[model samples]
Target: MVNSTQVSYFTLTAYFDTGRLKHLYFLVVLTLYILIISSNVLLIVVISVNRSLHEPMYMFLCSLFVNELYGSSGLFPFLLIQILSDVHTVSAPLCFLQVFCLHSYGGVEFFTLAIMSYDRYLAICYPLHYNIRMTSNKIAVLTAVLWVYPFLSNVFLVFVLTVPLQLCGNLINKVYCDNYYIVKLACSDTTVNNICGLVKMFTVILGLIVLIIYTYIRILKVCFSGSKQTRQKVFSTCTPHLASLLNFSFGAFFEIVQSRFNLSRLPNMLRIFLSLYWLTCQPLVNPVLYGLKMSKIRNACKDLLFGRKIYL
Candidate 1:
C-alpha cells in the first residue's frame, strides 16, 4: 500500500503584481462581489415576498440566483482575503471546500437552466395541463434534486479520488484551488480520477445541454405555430435564458481552452481573467438580465425599490 501524505496549504496566484496598484485591484474586486451579492439577494427577496411571483418559472429563476450566490461566495471571500494579504495561501480543507462549492455551482447551474427550459416548454406548449404537470410539490422536488445531485457527485469525487492521493506540490498556479489543479499535484496515478471526472462531466454538463436543446426545439415549434401574442410571450421568457446560456457557455469554453492548450505566452492577468470570467460575470448578469428583460420581474423590482405598484 502507498503511504499518503497531505498538503497543509496551497499558494494561489494573486490577480496582479504586488505593487501600489494591488489596493486598487482589491477595491474593484470587492465592489464587484458586493454587487453580485446585493443583486442576487434582491431578486431572491422579490420572488419570495411577492405572491404573484411565486410560479414555477420564478421558482426556478430563484434557484438560479441562489446558486449563483452560492458559487460566488465560494470564491469571493477567499479572493478578498488574498487581495488584502501579503501571501496568497489557503488551507487545504478550505481549498477542498471551495472546489466543492464551485464545481457544484456549475453543475447546479446547468441543471437549473435545463429545468427552466422545461418549465417554459410545458407552460407554452401544454397550457391546459401546465398546472397539472408542474405542481408545487413537483417543482420543489426538482429544485432539491438539482442542488443535491451536484453536491453528492462532488462528494464522491473528492472523497474517493482526491482525498487518497499523495500530493507532490502545493503551489496552485491559479487564484483559487481548482480540482484539476489539485489532481495535478498527486503523485499517484490519476487515470481513475480522470475517467471519473469525465463521466461526471458528461452526465451533469453535457446531459443538461442536450435536454435544454430538446426542450427549446419543442417550444420553438409551438411558438411558430401559435398567434403573434404567443410568439411574443415565448420570446420574452426565453431571451434571458438563451443570453445567459451563451454568456456562461463562452466562459466555460475559455476554461476548457486554457486547460487543453498552451496559451502561456498570454499575459498572466489575461489568462486569469479568462479563467474566471464566468464566476465574475454570471452572478451579476443573471439578475440584471431577468430584472430588466422580464416585465413582471422588472415591474416587481421597480415596485420594491420605488414603492409604486405596477400590475402585470
Candidate 2:
C-alpha cells in the first residue's frame, strides 16, 4: 500500500477459497512434487553412475535434470504451504529468491536445449569429428556458461531492477513470484526495466531460434542423404531432443503470453495453470520423455530399479 521497501510481504490474490478441499489439493500437489523429484533424480543418478552413458548428450541431460529439481524446489514447497494456510503471503526477500531461481531455471533450460541441438547437429552431420569438437573440456565450459549467464541475467533483473523499485500495492495476481508481475507493481518509473526486459527477451529468443533452425536444417540434410543406418541413428537421438524442446516451448509460450498480455478476463483456474505449466510440466515430462525414449536411459532406469544388468 506504500513504498516497495516497506512492503516486506506480498499478498497472492490468485489463490481462491478452496475451503475444506484444501487438503485434497495439498495431497495432489504433494504427490506431483514427489513424482517430479523421484523421476528427475532417477535419471540424473542413472546418467552419472553409468559411465557408458556419460557422453556429451547425456551429461547435458544430467544438467537439465538438475535444473528441473532446482525449479520445482522453488515453487512446490511454497504452494504446499499456501494451500494449507489462510494467509497467502510471501516475504519480499523469499519472493525475490524464488523469482531468481525460477527465471534461471527457464534460461538454463532453453540454453541447454540449444546446446543439445548443436550436439545432435555435430553427431549426425559430422560423426567422425563430433568427439573432437565436443570434447569433455568444451562440454564442461559450455555447461558452465549456460548456468552462469542465466544466473547473472536474473541477478540483474531481480536485484538491480526489481528490488529497488517503489510499490503502490503488495498484491500479486498470480500464484508464484514472477519478475514481470513484480516489475509491474513498481510505483516508480519502469521505463528502463521494460526496455531492457524486452531487449533481453528478444535478443535471447532470436539468437537461439537462429541456432536451433540452422542446426535442424543441417541435420535434416544429413538425414536424407545418409544411409538407412544414419537415418535411424538421427531418428532415435533427435526424436527425444525435439520432443523435449517442443514440450518446453509450448509451456513457455503460455507463460510468456500470460506475463506480457492482459489475460485477467480468463478463468482463475486457467490463468493459474498457465502460470504453473512451464515449471510444473517440464520437470515431470522431461524425465519421462528421455527415460522412455532414449534406449540407454530406459534400460538404465530399469536396471537400477529392477536389479537387472543391461548393456547399452
Candidate 3:
C-alpha cells in the first residue's frame, strides 16, 4: 500500500489462515512457552539457591539459562498473538526491537558456550590451576563481556544501520522479524550494511567458533591422554556443552541457509519449524541436557520439584 520510505509497519506474509485450528495452535505455543519459562527459571533458581552450585561452571550455565529466557521471550509472546490474530503485522519499531533482542540472544549464547568450553579446558587440562586461572574477578569480567557486547553491538547495529534503512517493501516472509530479511527489503544502497554484516560473520561469529574449537581440541587432547577415570569425568562434563553447541550450530546453519538460499519451496510448516528451531529448541534442550546429564543439576532439580530438603 506504500513505498519503502513511507512504510510504517511490516506485514508478515508467511502466516497463513489456520482457520479455527489457530486456537489449537495458540494452545500449543502457549504450552511450549510455559514449559520453556518454567524449565529455564527452575534451573536459574536451583543454581542461585543451592550454595553447592555456586561454582564458575554453574554460574556460566545460569547465564545460559537466563539468555534462553531472554531469547524466547522475544518471539513466543508475539508468536502467540500472531497465531490468534487475523492480521500478521508489526510496527517497524517493534520489529526492530525483536531483531535486537534475538540477535543479542544469539551472540550471548555463542560466547557463553565459548566461555564454557574454555572453562572445561581449564578444569580438565590445568586441573589445579583452574581456580587461580578462573578466579571470581575473571569470571565476572567474562560474564559482563558476553552480555554487554551482544547488547551494545545489536542495539548499535539495529538503531543505527537498520532503523534508518529505506525499505522497498514491508512484507516480511517469515514467521518472525529478522534483520537480514529487513535488510533485503531495503530500497536504498546497502553496500555498507552488507560489508558490516560480512565483517561481523567472519570476525565476531567466526572468532567465537574458532575459540570454542580450539578449547575443545585442547580438552580432547587432554581427554585421550588422561586415565580412564579422567576420561569419564571429561566426558560427563563436556557432553552437555558439546550437545548444546551442535544443536545450536545446526539451527544456525539452517537459518543461514534459509536466508541465503531458496527455501520457499519447502512446506510452510517445515519452513516455520526451521525458522523457529534455533530459538525454541535451545531453550528447551539446554534445560534437559544440563539437568539430566549433570548429576548436580539433576539432583537439585529433583529435590526442588519434590519438595525435598536433601542436597547432594
Candidate 4:
C-alpha cells in the first residue's frame, strides 16, 4: 500500500460472499458446465462423422460449437476452483489468458454468425450459383479467418495494449477477467488503449452486426418473393441463426453497457448475472436450438444414436 508496484493477483469481488451457498452454487455451475460440454461435443461429433452433414452450414455450426466449449472451458474450471477454494483470486497471467479466450470467443461468435448469415443469403437468394460461390475451399478459408482473426486481435489487445499498463489496484469487481476492467484499474492514462479498443470493437462487432442485418434483409426479401417450398426452406435454416443471434446480442448488450458505466445501484447478483449471461447462455442454447429446430441435424443425430435411418 505504500507505493505502486506490479500486481500479481486480482481478487474477484462479484461472487457471493456467503459461504453457506457455495456448495449449492458449485453444484449448479458444475451441472451446467457438464450439460454445456456434453451438448456441444455431441453436436460436434454428429456433424463431424455424418458425411451428409458435411456441408458449409454444418461445418460452420461445428466450429461454433467447438468455440463455445473453448470459451466455457476457459472460465468454468477456474470458477469451480474458486467456488471450492477459500480465496477468489486469479494470477495476472491466468487472468489475461481468460480475457483472451472469452473475448476471442465473443469475437469469433459474431464473425462466424456473420459468415453463417452470408451462407444463408447465398443459398436462399442465389440457389443456382450458391455451390460455386460457396465452395469447400472458400468455406474452409472463411472458417480459418473466423478463428484466427479474433485470436490475433485479442492477442494484440492483451499483450501490446494491456501488458504495458500500470495498474493501481488488483481487485476486479466482476466474476471474470475483462479487458475493460483491467484498463479501468490502470494507474496511468489509458487514452490510447481506450481508443484502440473502441475502434477494434466497432470494426469487428459492429461490422458483423451490419453484415447480419443486410444478409437477413436480403433473405427476407427473397423469401417473400419465392415459392412456398423456398419460404419453408429459408425459415427452417434461418430461424435457428436468428434465435442464437438475438440471445447472444441481448446478453452482450447488457454486459457491454454495464461495463462501460458505473452501475453501482444495481444489485450485485444482477451485475454478476449480466456479466456472465452470454458465457452461460450461448454455449448451452446454440446446440439445443440447432439440434431440435433443424430437421436435418435432428434426424442425423437420431440416426447416429440409433444406428439406423430414422426418417430417410
Per-candidate TM-scores read 0.94, 0.96, 0.97, 0.95
- TM-score of candidate 3 versus the correct structure, residues matched by position: 0.97
Best by lDDT: 3
Total clashing pairs for each candidate: 0, 1, 0, 0
Model 1 TM-score is 0.94
TM-score of 4: 0.95
Tens digit of lDDT per residue, candidate 3, span 1-312? 234446778999889999999999999999999999999999999999888999999999999999999999999999999999899999887898999999999999999999999999899889999999999999999999999999998887898888788877888999999999998888788888888888998999889889988999899898899899989999999999999999999999889888788987899999889889999999999999999999999998898889987445
Query: How do all the candidates rank in terms of lDDT, highest first?
Result: 3, 2, 4, 1
| TM-score-best of 1 and 3 | 3
Model 2 residue runs over 4 Å out of place are 308-312
What's the residue-level lDDT of 242 in candidate 4?
95
- lDDT tens digits by residue: candidate 2, 1-312: 467778889889999998999999999999999999999998988888887898999999999999999999999999999999999999999999999999999999999999999999998888899999999999999999999999999899889988889888888888988888887888789998988887987898679989999999999999999899989989999998898899899999999898889997999889999989999999999998899989989988889899765444
Instruction: Flag clash pairs in model 3.
Output: none
Cα lDDT tens digits, model 4, 1-312, are 211236878898887666789899899999999999999998998888878888999999999999999999988998898888788899988998899999899889988889999999999889899999999899989999999999998899888888778887888888888888888888787898989877977887778889999999999999899899989989999999999999999999999888988888998888888898989999999999999999988988888788875333
Q: Rate the local accuracy (lDDT) of all candidates.
A: 0.86, 0.91, 0.92, 0.88
In model 4, the runs with Cα more than 4 Å from the true position are 1-5, 309-312
What range of 10 consecutive residues in model 3 has the weakest lDDT sum?
Answer: 1-10
Report clash pairs, candidate 2: 4-167
